[model samples]
Target: MTSGAITFGVKLPNLSPLASRDSILTTGTVAERLGFTAVWASDHVVFTPTTEHDHPDRRFPVGFDTPAVDPLVALAAVAGATERVELGTSVLVLANRNPVVVAKAWASLDLLAPGRVLAGIGTGWQENEFHALGAGDRFRRRGSATVEFIDILRTCWSDPSDGFTGEFCSFGPIHFAPRPAAGIPILLAGRSDRGLRRVASHGDGFHGTNLNPAAAGEAIARIEKYAAACGRATASRRYTTLCELDLRDRPVGPDEDHGGIHLVGTPEQVAERIRAFDAAGISHLALRVRALSGSTRKEISNRLSVRAGVEQLERFEAEVTPLIA
Candidate 1:
């Protein structure tokens, strides 16, 4: 948990339909070669197009027709392809799957990759997804469920001898082997008070999204306060953010405003923004290129070619990493 140097991670292009397994592997390999610290995959079990619901964050819309690669599977692919970069889930909805199954899968993954796996979890916002996964009953209590799930995961990973009994999840003492070599670090994702509180209590770090440097700094302070209240040491708590990257030399529109949450503008500008985040106590910054303007999944996929994605990553590595490192 020692800290000082800022680390950077790139989100694998798993959201676009055009992103094939080969493309995902290529992005991860390129990131590791370029000196990135980690590569992240996002999660979504299912997207029902027929459902009429606006996303909680109106800025980013989720199209049901858009294909999303399974986070765990995608990360496994990246783990096999790259030997250095940490494999991460940007925000895996923990409540969607059984904690026991998740613990086993992650434990095996940790063994396979040794200390290069990061479990970034979240209490998902999609009610439909929960219902689709047969976890509708647990959806109402997701906040508590997430906390309990983490507890279960830790017990299963660190001490199988001690069985777990909780409101949502209970399991008898069972043999779980091949535990993580260094123990996987759990990073909670979200900007809500409850989410931050969970990070303070149960998480080893905070994974924030849609936040500017100033906001991330403030959030870190809040997490420290909550951690202190919970009688937990906050000295080594990791703070990371997922920011939209605009590699264009000039601002395109209101979306690319200098003061906005996204990291937009020239490579130098982006590097300065990374420095600001570092000053804010953010240890890691996960960047994703902004999606092109497209109403349909096909249109968006057409805009986000594997070549374009790789080029953007290369640009950041060459122009921004040097300034930050």
Candidate 2:
């Protein structure tokens, strides 16, 4: 990653070859053309039953009725459409899928995208989705399982001499072909204090705290403390955290507020806050352009339309990218 400007990426809502697919691809490509650093997709095996207001903390802006696209597939399509932009999952829940399968898919993506793949992974939150996929048992100890799963992936990618033996994932002497030409950057996401500790100990980096910047700063400190303790000072360079941005409606101002959760306001305010995060030690900020998890008023909803999505990309490029550059 370049050292000067911390990277900015947007999450594209791609559920299928739906009516919105072409628009998202075109809009995402436009974002690349306008100078956004990367594009990301969310992961969900299946939508769990819930009302928009059911889980008060849930943030899918369009609500449960909207389609949930496979992040890998959506990213692959986005990769085809754009050039010079990194692609990633805001987070792919590893508990629901075989880690080996994910390893292969992400590795292959790296092959095609070359140096432009970021592996953002999480343990998962929806137990019913796992049950629907016959992977419910994997959730019993997801925290532990996620660690082992990532270890297995590393083993498969790294030299076979670097082996692994864990309770959930164990393997020996398997040749996985076409190792990613450039190693994929793996980012781990979780909110627990223990989860932060785990990231410090075993992960390549840390991920988002949803909308909590204070907690993210604290988590960064925790990671640094543990990194220093474990003789992993070199690994400290890999820390990345996500920043939630809600730009639905507001004038640009440094004093702009997001209810203390996200960077709300115009592009400059968002970028300035992002710079603050960079100063605090965040390497990446995953931008969610649409309200993928909440409700919006009619006009704000209109701004989230495909056309306005392109405008936001342009605004960020013009107002935000230069500050970091």
Candidate 3:
């Protein structure tokens, strides 16, 4: 961990064709070598025509038409390729799969990476995805299902027998083995009220997106308030977030506000935003950088080639890492 700066991770283009074996291996190795604390793989099971998130920021994973790779499988390959960088799913939508099975997959990922897996998860927004996965019925109740889902994961990794009896799933006795030597950490992502409460109730951490210092602090306060109300211990809870990184040679004037969706500008300017996020209580910061700058907005792009994405990340390592470290 570098002092004076938050732990940093690069978001891999894992959801696209760029997640080819060669690309994953290269990206993971390069990020680890560049001193990144982790390399994250974003998840999606199937992309329908309705899959364009079209977030106002136009972030990566903008279109579902792109070739998609399974996040856990990609990261497992990355685990064999890199020695240290943490492998994360920058959220697997819990309602899209059976928790018992996905829990095993994540545990197996840990066997490969040891304590290096951050099982970043969330109750997904795309209700259609649940239908595609044949779990459509779980989407509406995904919130409560996810709470039980986390319970299932904990039992899978730490307990020998299954004894849960949730509305979505029920099991009496089963043998699950070769549990992870280091228990996997579940970091829940959400911005809604139910989402925040879910994190405070069951998550080892909170995973936020597109937030600035004030916004981050405000959310953390909410998580704390929720945790206190539930009598959940807050000391071990971690806070991490993903923000867009747009670095160009031109300087962003001091007056520009990116609305917290982006950390855009020259390396120096972006570094300042990074520092602010660090001060705002982000222990780990995941930057989703792209090869090109924007599909629609002045910033944000999902059209990333392996070569260009790697180059952009290398540039951040050379230019931004020093400013913060």
| TM-score of each predicted structure versus truth | 0.91, 0.85, 0.92
lDDT by residue for model 1 over 126-223, one digit each (tens)? 78889999999988889999998999889889887868889988878899887886789999987889878999999999999878889999999999
Candidate 1 global TM-score: 0.91
In order, the Cα lDDT scores of the candidates are: 0.79, 0.69, 0.79
Q: Which wins on lDDT, candidate 1 or candidate 2? A: 1
Off by over 4 Å in 2: 1-4, 15-19, 50-56, 160-165, 244-256, 291-303, 322-325
Cα RMSD of predicted structure 2: 3.6
Which ten contiguous residues of candidate 2 have the minimum total lDDT?
A: 293-302
What TM-score does candidate 2 reach? 0.85
Model 3 lDDT at residue 282: 83
lDDT of 3 at 314: 81
List, residue by residue over 1-325, the lDDT tens digit for candidate 2: 2327576677775732232667668756875876667887777767666544445565544545567777888788888877799887878898677877888999888877888888888888777777888888888888888888887777777765545677876666667876887678778887787777777777778777554556667888887787788788677455555554565356754343544446677656666677677777777776765533222222244234566556666666666666667
Q: Pick the candidate with the highest lDDT.
A: 1
In order of listing, the candidates' clash counts read: 0, 9, 0
| lDDT, candidate 2, at 37 | 77
